[model samples]
Target chain A: MTALPMEAEILTRREESPGLFTLHLRLTDSAAQQAYRFRPGQFNMLYLYGVGEVPISIVSDPREARHIGHTIRAVGRVTRGLERLRPGDRLGLRGPFGNGWPLGDCEQRDVIVVTGGLGCAPVTGAVQYLMRRRERFGHVNIVQGVKHADDLLWREQYECWDRMPDTTVLIAADEAGPLWPWHVGRVTDLFDRLRFDPAQAIVLCCGPEGMMLAVAEQLQERGIAAERIWLSLERNMQCGIGLCGHCQLGPKFVCRDGPVFSWREIAPLLRVRGR
Target chain B: MATDCTLVAELRFLAAADRQRLIEALREAGYAVHGPRVQEGVIRYAPVERIEDLPRGWRDIQEPGRYRLRQTDENRLFAWAAPAASLKPLVFPPREILFHARRDADGRLRFEAADGAAPKLAVLGVRACDLAGLYLQDRHFLQGAHPDEAYRRRRRKLFLVAVHCAHPADTCFCAATGDGPVARYGFDLAISELEEGWLLEARSHAGQEILDALPTRAAGETQRKAAEAAFRQAAAAQRRRLPGGDLPARLGGRLDAELWQAVGRRCLACGNCTAVCPSCFCHAHVEETPLTGARTTRLRQWDSCFTAGHSLLHGRPVREDTASRYRQWLTHKLSGWHEQYGRSGCSGCGRCITWCPEGIDITAEAAAIAGEEA
Candidate 1:
């Protein structure tokens, strides 16, 4: 409900993952402070001032609120404009909007966060939250896939997760060079290797729409209920509010209603979802 | 005390000479007085410098079968609406610079949104249909999630002076959408043209003062009845009806009805329908930064959903064929708009129904969809 005009500033910028770059920003006014009140799975509109704005999910954890980090890919004009920004540059920003990942539901449940490509951005927010409260849940698992070894993001973070006592990190790629030691195939291949019971897991998945649909079906086949699997949708977010009529996936505003929703809540909308 | 059925009988009427005086007064009052004046053959919205300049002896003949500019003996400036154009571009603008990015000599970047200029426009003779269009577009632009700053700036600065329609064009269906031919809310004043001058009524404080300052009048009940009857008859004459108010909700259940493919064969996809509509407010923003770093600006251009490029992604347009695009357009107008904004996006101005290159009429289309559904 906080409606502030987007501030244009680039506090710091660097490429972190394949096709994914991170910008650590010192925003106009109290962007850092307001970011904490942001829930995981929320999004913000990044404006390149003269270029216009594009909605991006906040990749960094809300608990680490000194600055905001967005793991963005160069997609359209405005994002490409954001990617071109260097350290100390200024870019416009609005929100911390959208109903993000439901952290409260995952508190006592076994967690499985599956992600692919740059779809990892919104899930990254939830992943950070889970990492901070590591002791609260049992059987924490992360399964990731990308086009190539270079396409995988968050190398250091995944390495750290791999080393965590109760956490299991499994990654796959379509084709592998000598650098990849993990499995070779699609993300769905990793689902068969998991030993956890789906009834006890709160599954959070983000990635290509086709991949997510297939994974959701796999989870269903493994007897996982629709309510347990959450998805971060990729749709047009022109206004990042309930207006503009651009970001409608059925009746839901991906900006205000959700950038994150249960697979169940959106089953009726999927026929027209991805576009 | 005679119940004053005087329906603003004591209200002032502007003399033919007073329009010139009013424009000068508005200029003095810091408002840009814009009214309908004949340029070529049509009466268009523009600045009025003289009383004679405002469209006199002109009327617009609109129909599903036809639309044209015709001459009438009436000298009322508010005689017709929106000749094939809505007041959308004047506020949101057809093309606007939304932001700019410039890389300085040291390679530092900066972004700035264009606030644009605010002209305190006194928009004269806006009809109820276009006002509804403005409100619906506001849902698309200003009322949704984030505010469209440039749109908000121009919209907030406007001083509306509306004129009630004394008649309805065959193409006009304002009655069906509840946006009657009579000018309604968000107007500072409403002007009803009469045999002599006009029945000028003020709803806001600015309107009262403007009328108070202009050449004045006091009237009997007869003139007031005439004005009310004129509005009612004009509203009644609207030929296009959406079966009933449930047209939108009913159409929601028929998304894949064969009527879409039925109409698809004739659509040219020229997008003249969207351009002429009062409520279509889609736009796209592109960043343009020159190689010299002189300026990198984000330009917001009027975009139509009918265009293949509007829905393009990953080098593929979503609605490549005309059928899907036309379906999105009509369904959005008749259904998707209500689902999102809680109201129909169409004002039933019939601009889209008339201006099609192939004459793809929407009223006939809706009737077909409903007829087949039944």
Candidate 2:
């Protein structure tokens, strides 16, 4: 509950793309490391020694509580500084905060994960969870879209998922490059080719607000209930708890109430600009 | 929490001249006394060691964007409705270091939290509206699943002395909010000022002990009546009011109202109103690193929705314009607060109205959105 930072050492580091990197960290304190547990969509306040903190979604599987992995894009001041750290470098960590993706609710239903831009990181853990317990769930569909083909990461992982039974992976790029294998269009365009029973499908979406809104609208048009559609939101989450008041969407503090919320819960506020 | 009627019935009279004894008693009991005093033509909370430190014979005239202090021949203390600031600064400080991250010789980084112990504070001359604001702050910082450690440490050591507001100002509207003119509860001692003396009552066990130490007598029927009349007069003098009953729901339905754009044009987004607000609790984190590069401290300072950075996401503001920012502040205070804290965030103390550089009256704005006049 305390906002104070816990020391964490970077166990491993990987460059996923030109600007995107992944850091696998382990809490220096054995007790804290052993006690730590997180869900797919929950985020941690990652602090670089002399820099500041930023809310980064955990991308590693929840079952492996030993080391946590976060896929981060070097965009802002904090993340850019975090990108420079090596495997042995130390940083401050404070979370496992915000509500995560509703993996439990999708046990017997088909799960559709729609992501745009660099939004696939938060749901990567959920997809892995479903893959591990493939018998517990029905069909698993993941749709991702990026500005350019060069912007996409984890190409091998996507190819591997596409080969699995009862699992479907579709990727799109707005400005397609040479030898691009996926579709060349917006994420919403994927729905025209998508096949599923709306009544048995649970859609989870993340990305830019416009993309999420479009995704939700397309799902609604396909007869998906708003209650069955969830989204991971983004805001200025300085405090992982609700105290900072920066991540408010009307009455909901996105950090406390959700990074993941049903479309039914945020539909009223999402459309209202500046809410 | 409302004051018990039975507790008020047992009121004791403390003469106007004997008020210094109460301050002395609190000081002797290991409390640092802070009370209202005239500073720079405005009433502010400051250190008080003697009765003379209180703003006696000074009446504050408050209006939209204006606050003036006038001295009269009258000797009554606490003639003003409210001070420029609330007791929030004493508990939840405007800026505080959350923790310090330091690197040792072994290249190990360590985080140490700021000191948790706080001085025992006895704050006098608390008005009912401010008390209500503090109550909401209590629920916000202390009643949640993750209670704020710094705020909790300071709050537990506070000994409050409530002063009933006998003279409500033009901007006052605590009565409409059902908060006060008379002090209700949440104080160690409640005092109702009268022409001759003060009617004092103890609401807590510590307050009873403090009352027992002071030389006091049973209040005469006439004195009690005079105090009750003062309370009534204060309530009746308030000219500003907000539409009562289910304001949260009502404000929710008015999200698209055109009033927001109209007010946004005038709003400078200077954030003065929020700085003076008793109940607003938005803060932003900052990092401070010394030139020595030995340690960096993470501090939090008071922040407002009016600031673009408060809602920033990847260097872009979620609330891009003043209209939306204004709506966010207003709706969150009057509407979203109900969902988060189970009540309206505003205590109706009128500090925001009086301190706003543009003279943006919240009561009038709320009423306008409700299709009513100011």
Classified by CAPRI criteria, candidate 2 counts as: medium
How would you encode candidate 2's per-residue C-alpha lDDT over B215-240 as one tens digit per residue? Answer: 89999988877777777777777878
Every prediction: chain A TM-score: 0.93, 0.98
Candidate 1 C-alpha lDDT tens digits along B58-104: 77876654567877887666667556677786787777776566656
CA lDDT, candidate 2, residue B256:
88
Cα error of candidate 1 at position B170, Å: 1.5
Interface RMSD of each: 4.4, 1.3
> What Cα-based lDDT does every candidate model obtain?
0.73, 0.88
Best-performing candidate as measured by DockQ: 2
- Per-residue CA lDDT of model 1 for A1-275, tens digit only, reads 11434454566778875455889865655744554457788887877655567777887768765477888888776677777778777766777788888888888787888898888878887887888898887778899989888787777889998998788899999988986889888888888777577777888999887888888878878888888889887666565676544555555666677778888987656655222
Give the least accurate 10-residue stretch of model 1 chain B, judged by summed lDDT: B1-10
Best by TM-score: 2
